[model samples]
Target: MRTKIILTATVLIGGAAFAIAQTSHTGHSDGMDHSAHQQEQAMTGAALSEPGQGAFAALSELVRVLEADPNTDWAQVDLAGLRAHLVDMDRLVMDAVVIETDLPDGISAIATGDADTIATLRRMVPAHAAQLARDDRWTVDATETNDGIELRVTSEIPAVVARIKGLGFFGLMASQDHHREHHFMMAQGKDAHGH
Candidate 1:
């Protein structure tokens, strides 16, 4: 009988403490609504959503697009190929060195780099030349060299000639708005940029 009475008293005290805690936290006793605290956290939380790097941001964007699309083939997804292409782009931009010479209308560039960079240039420059050739205003060509790649751009339009010369090799390489669509196509396992 004595043990049962002590157990009942302990249970009553515990329940009362729990009820008080609930009332205070729920804004019934302390008069501050916890809902406001939750709203503040939602408004000013320190958890950022950035991917924190360029290539990663690009990949994440592609992932989001793929996830949102019902027609995306999960089996055919080729993010690794896309990443390799991104690395090639990085090498071309960051590592390749170019010497420019005057052409009648535009410019010629002897683009050279380390072996890996040269390899990247070999893969990219000709493909870019093909893309530029599609424009009627410009003539573009790239040739493989023993050490690097040679690229020439010429245009009959005087203003365009000036622009092409101003752009030179790297800028011309970076030119055109086809990259995003090409990346999308590549992620979809399509022959974007002809490879």
Candidate 2:
């Protein structure tokens, strides 16, 4: 009987404490609302505070167009800068293969060939392939005119196959994530020391 009475008192005290805590925190449980914060950010021009301001600006414009007109044809929109960047990226990958011969190679080549060039080629080709895959400018389509040699995005725009079609090279030979990381870091604002 004594133990039961003591246990009932403890439960009553604990329940009262929990009720007080709930009443005290009733109006403040949700904390800061992020959607409202984002709205304020948009109002005060904090939306474009990132280092890639131009890219963000372009994205904002695209968003605005889509929001204003649901039927907006984004492909027909004037994305000159975006298009130029895409084209430049594609051309860079295609050109990366040209400088491949300067790399080093081991005893894998034929009787007469520069080993360094072979090595460089082996490294660069994979990098080129990865870049080509990521480049959104050139779309990969099936109805290409040249079988396995050329890739067609549309009826008008055509580019060469990315996988070294004649040489049978299909995948990246070295790490390509580093290249992506480097590009992303470069896109960000420079440090105080211009790094």
Candidate 3:
């Protein structure tokens, strides 16, 4: 069972990685050169950016190269940085919880909890979706509920669901409740201060 789960998770991660590859900005004829832009970013190392932007950018570039040539030299890739980024992602996942509902064609997951917890989900889900959107694997919609806010994530791919589930502390609460009542819990690695 564990092996099966790991295999499934691997497939999902690969699918999501492919989505990232497709969305990465390459040099296009529209006068927008992603390569040049990426270079600029590397040179500047801009601050005050989103939490995982740099890691996401690195993964995006790596995906782009791998897609272009599957046989590319592994030595050229930043394995350490990639590992660090994934660790960061795991940490973030460990700190949050998601309530999942199985829809007819897809899945709907809502982050439920206290005001601050909901707010954290509000911030993280879209940002995560935005990163995934670059790969075209997920679409995110938000609605204001009596509790706080609910994120409606829709994806046609089963791998997307699998990927979301693979995130730690995610998919803990599964319900058919489209009625929108918030029930929050503090996931592992989160303190009483909500940090």
Candidate 4:
């Protein structure tokens, strides 16, 4: 019964979000801006949620979350930063090139791309490497090379080593679940990477 209720709620919310997208999406050319806030205001039947695109959906969700919070300082809110970060994420996943070297216990790679992708990679990999380093299961290192960013990840446990090797650099980057919190903070004009 509880499962059915949860599933029903999910379906209803999804339907509402779709209706909102069909009604509201204008096919903007660039990143999401303050228009998301306007979209938030334009909601109908409390059904308007999640814009058509992934980044827009994420931004809109945060806008809703922040707006609902009692202490949110609108003056300090910086959805632009979050939008920029989301663009960086797209670049990292879609554009960056990973040159992998398989290791006995793990893997190493020099992640490279065009100028913009390289810049995003340099900023992102090291920060995430720092995050990965804190985990006892793996030893992670990221260093800047002339052409790209070099990532080395290894593990002490045999099972973990196999997992690390399988994950490789890109998968390793996707391992830690920090992007959501970082997005919220970035949207609030704060640097989660402190960079």
Task: Give the alpha carbon lDDT tens digit for every residue of 1-195 in model 4.
Answer: 999999999999999999999766664544557667677777743555557889889998999999899999899899987888889888999999998998887889889999999999988899999988888988888999998899999887999899888888778989889889888888888879853
lDDT of 2: 0.39
User: What are the per-residue Cα lDDT tens digits for candidate 3 across 73-180?
Assistant: 556444454444344444445554556676544456655565555555555455444444454565656555555445555567888766544432243222222111
Candidate 2 regions off by >4 Å? Answer: 1-34, 42-60, 70-195
**Candidate 4 clashing pairs, residues 3+ apart or interchain:** none
User: Per-residue CA lDDT of candidate 1, range 72-149, in tens?
Assistant: 999999999999998998889999998999898999999999999999999999988888788889989899999999
**Per-residue C-alpha lDDT of model 2 across residues 1-195, encoded as one tens digit per residue:** 999999999999999999999886675556846577589788888744443444455445455545588665555444444434334343333432321211121111111123433333343333354454564543332111111122222112222332232222222322234443333323332211111
The clash numbers for all candidates, in the given order, read 0, 6, 2, 0
- Candidate 1 or 3, higher TM-score? 1
Reference-based lDDT, each prediction: 0.89, 0.39, 0.50, 0.86
**Candidate 3: regions farther than 4 A off:** 1-97, 157-195
Which of 2 and 3 is ahead in TM-score? 3
Ranking by lDDT: 1, 4, 3, 2
Residue 91 of model 3, lDDT score:
43
How many angstroms is residue 162 displaced in model 2 relative to the true structure, after the best TM-score fit? 31
Give each model a TM-score: 0.75, 0.20, 0.33, 0.74
Once fitted onto the true fold, the runs of candidate 4 whose alpha carbons sit more than 4 angstroms away are: 1-50
**Candidate with better TM-score, 1 vs 2:** 1
